[model samples]
Target chain A: MTEGLSEAGLIAVVCEACGAPRTPIGPGDDAALVIAPPRGRQVVTTDALVEGVPLVEGVHFLRAHPPEALGWKALAVNLSDVAAMGARPSAFVLSAAVPEGLPAAWWGAFARGLAACARAAGAALVGGDTVRSPGPLVLNITAWGWTEGDAVLRRDGGRAGDALMVRGNIGRSTLGLLNWLKLAESGWGVDGAVRDDALAAHLRPAPPLDAGPWALAHGASAGMDLSDGLATDLPRLAAACGLVLEVELAALPVDPVCAGLTPDERAAGGEDYGLAVLVPAEHVGAFIARGFASLGAARQPVGGERPGVLWRRHGAPTELAASAFAHFSGG
Target chain B: MTEGLSEAGLIAVVCEACGAPRTPIGPGDDAALVIAPPRGRQVVTTDALVEGVPLVEGVHFLRAHPPEALGWKALAVNLSDVAAMGARPSAFVLSAAVPEGLPAAWWGAFARGLAACARAAGAALVGGDTVRSPGPLVLNITAWGWTEGDAVLRRDGGRAGDALMVRGNIGRSTLGLLNWLKLAESGWGVDGAVRDDALAAHLRPAPPLDAGPWALAHGASAGMDLSDGLATDLPRLAAACGLVLEVELAALPVDPVCAGLTPDERAAGGEDYGLAVLVPAEHVGAFIARGFASLGAARQPVGGERPGVLWRRHGAPTELAASAFAHFSGG
Candidate 1:
């Protein structure tokens, strides 16, 4: 016989796996708390995912996307925001709605994934509510964190002469989604390693957890994560900082996997999960020496005070109309 | 052209109506705070409402039930929980999903109602999220409050011989639901005053906010609000306290409308929103003389210790069967 557990049962199962006791007041309490840094400020943000937008079954992820990955993704995306602010995540509250009769194992995996992510992010699952829903599953997570000092970064601080740098290689998740779509449409099997990495990238896109602090310590003028894509995010960063961003097309860094794709395909695809920031010219060399050694990359400028993103193809600089990312264009 | 506002627009509109200053750290921030009591404990609770469960369009309130009322109800129910703990509500966070194209006017009214309710309750709308859904709207609200000294009350503190007491009349919301149902079914219009009260009871159910602090101040043992009706909430209170709660049928303060209902209708219906508490026998008179008189009525012993709730009707005592309000079996 299958175990017939309710929402409360699922919560208990996951809470057991997530053993960190950061919350003096945990689940079952009205609210949970994480210790605040004595001198720093606390940051909080919330995001909601509905079934149709941003999350569609059999499209965004598999219809059977590991429940744990679902849970992890839900919290991880919010944590990225905290990381962007150069804060260490401390607590999170989740509110979820699931259709009745969802399997207990599904919830177990979901909770396990959530717990694992929370532990990895140095956060505690504080408190949340669960209820039955008549539609597709919905998860809304609220994350809180604190930073010690006035080192928190915002997108509005970039300067005209600052160098634009990104923490990691981009376009992996977009490629993964493309691969998945190709597989689903053509019924062709890919190599195990390739499929695994692609799916992992889509399911658990890595956000640079240490990048926020690294940038703060090294004097990054302004920064944000490239959840939308460099093309879209850079414009936002530029707008926030009240400057025009110029890019040298010849210096554009494209993933090896992306090299094989059509330029358009490589331009507008979303979900890169890379960190982008502006560093003043004076700090750029020091950042390259200390930060690049840590992140395993040489700090490279992708853009400057130009009007738009420019990319070099075949050794010639060319303006790229847009980068790979989805825009909220009132669909 | 119609106002094509984004999700952010809706939030700004509501926040403006609330007249609560947008926190230096507001909704877009990771979390929000109001000045919590420095020396006292914070009270907290959460409640969720699903479309088909606690509410059905046109059945529960009206198809035209103002959006503001829905927002108010979302916060109010959780506020009732804080009040049950004898705490003054300070802040609330709301999460909601509504069908796309839900009228802007509806949203405006909803925000107005939410603002009014928050102001009246002395609570601030600290943060919330709104999303578009494909199904009926769902609202989940979390409320936090604070209490001074050793004044907070809990459900586990009642002794076996303590006198069970309730503040305010019960079964009004339930009657209101029934009356609305009758009006809908019979095609009969309700009188203005009756309609107004019934709708008010359904839309803006009065919670015993003051009674919570009063009961705690005057030495009430265990306390909880009657959201699940007296029949259901009382039993849980009894179980939590590990005592048999024998409610004297004669002392059950039924509303005048409830008094007119059939016994079965009154018994199975829920939504009283009154405070049910246990007071020690010694302090019962004091509570009655001070707290109860100032509030509404005096405390009356309803029943004696046995195993479960026993009700006396027509001078004969019998086990009261589990009411419909106890949605789960084996209560």
Candidate 2:
């Protein structure tokens, strides 16, 4: 669909699909002009999605899934990072390297999806660049947000005795991915409401956008978005804070579709885009009341124990395989 | 070279190569935090490069050129846009997709080049994401800069009587690209100092970083960096300002190596990364004293002359091919 379209034409398609720019300056100039955030600090993050690389696990993202869904996922993933910083998204820029075979309609649909996400996050698609690639389709989004004063959240703020909590449904995206891979159990059924729910989770993750700022305002100690699942991400938080995060498998707020899955499967499967947070013991009650489920607590590493996640089951220390998906690890 | 390295290890390699980030929070966090511009507005832009698509021409950026050169070119091109806006670059975020076959050493060298540019631009490499791709290498850089109040150079600010001027050498990158392709005429020689100069222009474009801000301060009406050559870009400025730009081919500040090329070749060959600026008539003397070369003047359209560039030579109107390499236009 993009056979004879000039680069400018493609850019126009994107700008039109994205509607008007919310900033003082928008696309079509040497650069976009935007109002600087008040409080003199801004949050920035970048993320990318590539064809043939599983958006979890499948070939369908490019070949079957709606191009709009792919677009939503690309922008949403970056938004999750901004949300983790407890910032309000202001604007975003995208660089898409697309193959010649991709229809112009597909590109427009993709832009619409991206625009939808930007609107939902209160961000404007301020600028971007489009180039033709002989390789697989690639989408990279860089998002910027702003926070008030020093109120932004940080991952290293947790301390021993802080309650570790999880918000949003854990393992939901993984369950959706498993369903796409046709690995669901018999009782789970191939086509059902649960499968649909799981599919939605995988395709368009709605990261809890308000949670980070809400938690920060209410005195949460530390937080990070859970993109890599508990087995992998919890330890990162623990290491950052120099404490051991001890969590019980039974307390995990697993997605309803993943009810029959094992604790390990639910804990290790990733791409949930949920918030794994730590709150002072004094604020745990307020945290839970705001919809965060307490997983366990941060503890001081004793004796030769290292600063990392300490898996527990029914009050007993447990050993669990903790391999999470890694890009270069060839997982 | 990255055989057994985990994702975190690869990220660490980049962080180390780039050295300490010049931001409050960088690389290791959910999102980097940067100080906002004092003027309450920012300039933002993005640009991308892909393998197999000519970095002007040839496969060397991945298969032959020093990975560092590729790194420098990627970021430099983006910085060119920020420079066009008369803004001081603050920080940048990069999203890089690497193939498994790319050596870890190559990635390290690439990071060094990127870091060098970041330091030179007075900006920091605050954050990025690295993901493995089964396709050609892709790099996208999003840069941010700050301006004092609304003191930005917009292409539309040119007046009908503004003097058209250019900063830096024109057709230099294209000459360098031609040298790399071994298409330089025999009289131009294959490996002399001129060739080296041209090659450097193509590989590590040193954009006129101070010109935009200086022009704005000196009452220049409008400005933009010439990435796609004046044949394509001048008309954009003219269109934005609702006027016709009349220019003399003899007035272009062509590179020494391009002495033998046709006027059109020198005019239309893209990627010069120079500034095509319009200064008010009152400031033309000062603009020239500051090292800008005057081309001609912006004029109100006469006899239905369209709002675009009007090529002239030896005091007479002339026609030009004006094909400035549009992506997907198949050149």
lDDT for each residue of candidate 2 in B68-148, tens digit (9 for 90 to 100): 777777888888899889887878888877766777777777778787887888877889887767788888899988876
lDDT of 1 by residue, B1-331 (tens): 1145567777877788877555434553324533434455556566656565324221223434446666677677778877887778877767766666667776777778778778889887767777766655666676667776545677767786678877754656666665565566765364322345655676677686888878888888778777766666766776666676655555555456566654544445566667877887777788666534211122323466344465656557765555543421211
lDDT of 2: 0.77
Model 1 chain B worst lDDT window (10 residues): B293-302
Best by lDDT: 2
Model 2 residue runs over 4 Å out of place are A1-6, A22-24, A53-61, A183-195, A321-331, B1-6, B22-24, B53-62, B183-195, B321-331
For residues A1-331, write the lDDT of model 1, one tens digit per residue.
Answer: 1148766675677678776342225664223433334466555566666655333321233335557777777788878877777777877777776666678877777778788789888888766777667655667777766666755767767776788777654656666666665565655354322346655665666687788767877798777766766656666766666665554433446456667555544444566666778888888887666543111111324455434444445555555543322321111
- Per-model DockQ: 0.25, 0.62
Position B13, candidate 2: lDDT: 74
For the predicted complex of model 2, DockQ is 0.62
